[model samples]
Target: MFKGLKPIQYAGREVWPLIEGGKGVSATNHASSGAWAAAGGIGTVSAVNADSYDEDGNVIPQVYEGRTRTDRHQELIDYAIEGAVAQVERAHEIAGGKGAININVLWEMGGAEAVLQGVLERTKGKVAGVTCGAGMPYRLSEIAKQYGVYYLPIVSSGRAFRALWKRAYHKVPELLGAVVYEDPWLAGGHNGLSNAEDPTKPEDPFPRVKQLREMMRKEGISDDIPIVMAGGVWFLRDWNDWIDNDDLGKIAFQYGTRPLLTKESPIPDIWKDELTKIEEGDVLLHKFSPTGFYSSAVKNPFLRSLQGRSERQIPFSTEKAGEHTHQLDVGVKGKNFWVAAGDLLRAREWDGQGFTTALKTPDNTLVFVTPEERAMIRKDQADCMGCLSHCAFSSWKDHDNYSTGRLADPRSFCIQKSLQNIAHGADPHENLMFAGHAAYNFKTDPFYSNGFVPSVKELVDRILTGD
Candidate 1:
């Protein structure tokens, strides 16, 4: 029997199957989350460097005044805690006891555990659940249990869930709220694409999530436990068979891209305008993140620049051997290095075109760049703030003498700088715009045909009619 989408118990309150996925750098803020909660759905507050407001509700820029990289890292932690606390407080007031609020964090972010503990301790009884992803978050359950809040671990495959359940999540099953299976190929933001998986080949999430449910059921978890499907979900009618199917068990849908156009969305007006104009394939999935993970972003000029940089790369050998016939003309010539004969002409052309500096990557390849670009890359690397547990860009590990013992990678960029700039009204084309593949639908969706931006309540109502 089809009863349509209805409310269900989540973290102590009955709420709709709808959930607003958390976006970092103040994209999902208090006003937007509060409005979602008021609409009888779970709202997520992004605890990843959330922004704090001034007395007049203006966003206060996060300026670092520290003299050292480690000092700046501490400043970042303080900012994360204070901003998350403020957002949670506002969300609680706006909810007015109607719906629940969940805090979202990335396990790979620098000082993730410390930020979670700090925010949870300060905002007692305010947050209902914690959603975490972007690495094996084994300690997430334990931390949530300590604070008496539900925990949702986001994974891309069944093997990941089985591993987490066998290791730590099984020990704290009471507060386990839901399992979020984010599609690696189609999802926005940081993807969980494993080594065995091909990024170019996308898989259907139906079978993947069903297998996850089977694994959970085998682990003694009830069928009532909802599996929230995130990434590439736009219309509920498109997923009719998944709603009440006995095989998939209880289900929910989460939207990270749809809410960006809503009235309460905190992003700049330029971002909203740009979203409407985005075409299919404008968003790209690439490996440019310093966290050594695959992430999806708009293929704007900023992303294109990175792609061009990688294209200019070529493999080289320290000494000439079999098939290593051409001498590297752009680099130290007397070093006995060799490159492919075909690449020698290209390298010479690039060098003649003022791209005189060559930087070596961890993969034993050399990337040629202009002197000015080379200087900028070095400066950005020197200003590393330890934003990730381990960064491939600056080679700054949070611990172990604060170095990964590897050369800084030029293929990746500092995510913190770009996200912050974009969130605070910078150019979207110049920043990394994370979005699901279905984001292109905004152009044709009748609801947004006439430049109409719905309120959170309006969006929820529209979603309820199965439109």
Candidate 2:
């Protein structure tokens, strides 16, 4: 038997504690999130490069015309603020004063504080809270206090929450809306897996959430402040024990993957169809993001190509030392390249296989690729608009000399380019498709059988029944 969920008081109103996960790059927009709020559940508008409309009510494509990376980064921030304000305004209109509306942003994104301040300034009463993650946001509470909105920080462990609470959040206790626990091994997109956590070993979320709750109690936080469980959540029936359990305290579910299949979802049709075809273990947790963070995505050719590139890598030394005795001649033009005997043969083999060009990485290694592949990688790097605060692929940093001071890594790709392409109408097989580990449930879940896609209302009602 499933324990039923009760409506909770939030943002000065009574509404269901359910929240729609805010997806980025135009995935979750006014349509889906607005409908979710209208269904009496909290809806989240993605403030990460949301879509803006032209006068004719058509989606305006974000095109950067700036000649330099820094200039183009400013353009990106402007687009983000404009698009987010529009999305919030439309969502509030669609909601008709039902459930509250929230906006989500990544603390590591370029010009994040500016974007948040700009959006909040324009849409004063529309947004109820700001959901931020991907990095430790000590200033989130301060920003929330400035705008009179609640702030929810997404964390993977109790230790992370403690750090935030001690540094800044304790001062603004009234506006700390909730703490989101995103499973690092299971959640989609940019994960919060720390260096101490093993990516291969997935830990259970129950004990972790319980630890977070206990820590919160010690900090004098009220039990009503929910620990919103995000990632890998499919059905409420499976989480019966978690609901109404005093150990966890005021739990709410946040669906990041399942809602992508709904009728109101703003993803492309091809992306929606691909969701149904996912099989078990199709999602991979990898560390290829340009932001130097681990992210989860579909293990398609796009991601496999990155893995293959990394596999073709071999360590090189400027001066001969230890096992680096063989002077490599293939792929690289410089005589300074020295490698091990076995790696030299492997490099030759890779060169013979059409990976004729070698690119240097920041880790003192070289990755072999075709000349055509090398050109594309270079072009993508040159075309970078500084989406993240720091990028490993282009070596572009938002502050301090505008460079990471390291060689741009060929092993990583331009995330802004790939996500924008996929969010538009690009082929799913060739783009980075982010999805949670539980995404495979779309295939086996009887609710999705017969290609029956539900509306936001239907999905919310069905979820309320513990399905």
Candidate 3:
């Protein structure tokens, strides 16, 4: 049972210590988030390219009609604002003025500030707070204050929180509702892994969260403010000690993966069905995102293809030096292309296998792909609508001529395309499926035996029982 756990005051209201973690690309939508809110928990709506519906309740396809990158970017922002507004309105109606609903956005997403402002302007009292991460969102507090809503910053470690608090969060201390400590290595989708931390070794979150509490106390922040512990959270029984621990005051749990199978979830039936079949170790943390941040997803055929591409890569030089005396079999700039003798043989072998096209990454590395793959990559890059603030894949920057002045990296793929396709009922195995590490629990959990899918209220009720 959820003993000694009480409702925490958040967004000027009392709500359960359960938060529905925001999943992007319409994974969490009006139906899912609204039900979560009505269930007395905080419902988080994903503002990253949210979806809007037509008069008949059909999804409005996000088709870009602009011929240029700049033109398409404006279209993207307009679509984002429209979609967020619709989602918030529906969620508010379903909530019946109970619980709280928060909108989440990534700081690195293109037109983030504009989209947030526009959505909030239209949403008005519907939204309770804003949860932002994926970068140091120093402006989140100030912006949320302008809209008269609370602001929550998602961070990994205490040092990161300290830096943000000192920089800008200090001035708006009253508006800072809560701080989320997302385990970078364990969380799904884009994470906040820093250079000091090793991804292969995940440190225990207990000590890290305790350090954050100490930092908060020293800063004169109230112990009443909740610390949302996200990542790898499946069962409350596993975290019994954390519920009422003095070291970490007012703790809450955020679930990013478990909610995908609920009846109200907006994802396609195929996606929900696949969640019940996941096994331990099926989730993989990799660095294939165009945002240049580490992300976790199911190890599907789509990810396996990227892994194979990177594995076949080899370093090359412009001029012959040392063991690089062999002539390159592929012509790019000229015969000036130089590689080690062994690499030349490998390149030839790859070419014979029809992986003939060579593409250069910004890191001065070459990855070989088939002609079809090369054409697809070029087409995706050309169709960029500035979806990210600074994309490493397409080099589409949201500022100044809309270019990052670097060659598009072939190692990264366009996230917008893959996520949108999956959410729209594409083959789950061929798309990037963001999932938490504990997603495998769905397969073994008795609550989901025989492919039983519960309503949002039933799920929340079950969670309160410490199942």
Cα TM-score per model: 0.97, 0.99, 0.98
Question: Compared with the true structure, what per-residue lDDT tens digits does model 1 show for residues 342-396?
Answer: 8888888888987788888988788988888888889888888888989999998
lDDT-sorted candidate list, best first: 2, 3, 1
| lDDT tens digits by residue: candidate 2, 208-288 | 999999999999999999999999988998888998899999999898898899999989999999999999999999999
Report lDDT (CA) for all predictions: 0.90, 0.94, 0.91
Candidates 1 and 3 compared by lDDT, better number: 3
- Clashes (N, CA, C under 3 Å) per candidate: 0, 0, 0
Given candidate 2, what's the lDDT at residue 10?
A: 87
Candidate 3 structure quality by residue, lDDT tens digits, 137-158: 9999989989999999999988
Clashing pairs in 3: none
